[model samples]
Target: NAGVTQTPKFRVLKTGQSMTLLCAQDMNHEYMYWYRQDPGMGLRLIHYSVGEGTTAKGEVPDGYNVSRLKKQNFLLGLESAAPSQTSVYFCASTEAGRAKNIQYFGAGTRLSVL
Candidate 1:
């Protein structure tokens, strides 16, 4: 099974353009997360879900939204993309409880905004 998958590995957007990034996992994980990686900084969480149909805001949630409609899928949306939002987006998942400490990440999606 595909451990974790991210769609549209690369994208270029103009200011104010909106886009949705998709994340899917076949591991049946109980936790899912969205993170952004920028130059010279550790990955920052954008949004996360504890389980299907449940979501929460993360450290950098502004200008972004997330939904987990199914146990294997998580979606991140940017309503008005900005240059500041351009970064490598990563999706990760892990098992519940004790196993949660270990997360598997998808190949990041690179986004550039002009």
Candidate 2:
């Protein structure tokens, strides 16, 4: 089973273009998250979903929107992309309320906005 999966592993966009990143997990996790890594910023959470249909904004959610329609899938959207928003986006998941369960990460999607 794929622990976590992200589509479109790499993308390039002109400023103001729109795109969506897709994430999926096969581990039946209840918690899913989206994070972006950039120079000096380390990693910052952009959005999360605690369960199917429940979503919330995270530390750097300003330019992103997320939806979780099924337990195994989470979608992140950039309505209007910008150069500053370019980064390596990662998706992670783990069983909810189990502190001992470590999150599993997908191979990140590298996005470049010009």
Candidate 3:
């Protein structure tokens, strides 16, 4: 109810299975982001959208796809699950002109692929 929230707080998937992770914000922010955190690797941006109906690839977009069909929602989809894709995923959002570093984040989604 404060800023952002991600659905399916935890998930487990088998190799080759497909799933979608959803991020929803109540702040009505124009910029939204998706990131993955790995052991000792820090967080890496997977994808982002500047505004509704617009999306861009980030540093680690190879195994992921994203969409922002509505201003309040962003979706990340994995076509085929893999062990390498397992990580803690976070969703963030902020005002268009606000400092990118100052973002509101979801509680995070834990995913494991076996």
Q: Point to the candidate with the largest TM-score.
A: 2
Q: Which scores better on TM-score, 1 or 2?
A: 2
Q: lDDT tens string, model 1, 1-103?
A: 6899999899999999999999999988999999999999989999999999999999999999999999999999999999999899999999889642789
Rank candidates by TM-score, best first. 2, 1, 3
Q: After superposition on all CA atoms, what RMSD does each candidate show versus the true structure? A: 1.0, 0.8, 1.4
50-96, model 2: which lDDT tens digit per residue? 99999998999998999999999999999999999889999999999
Native-referenced Cα lDDT, model 3: 0.94
Task: Tell me the TM-score of model 3.
Answer: 0.95
Alpha-carbon lDDT, every model: 0.95, 0.95, 0.94
Segments of candidate 2 deviating more than 4 angstroms: none
Backbone clashes in each candidate structure, one number apiece? 0, 0, 0
What are the models' TM-scores? 0.96, 0.97, 0.95
Candidate 1: the clashing residue pairs are none
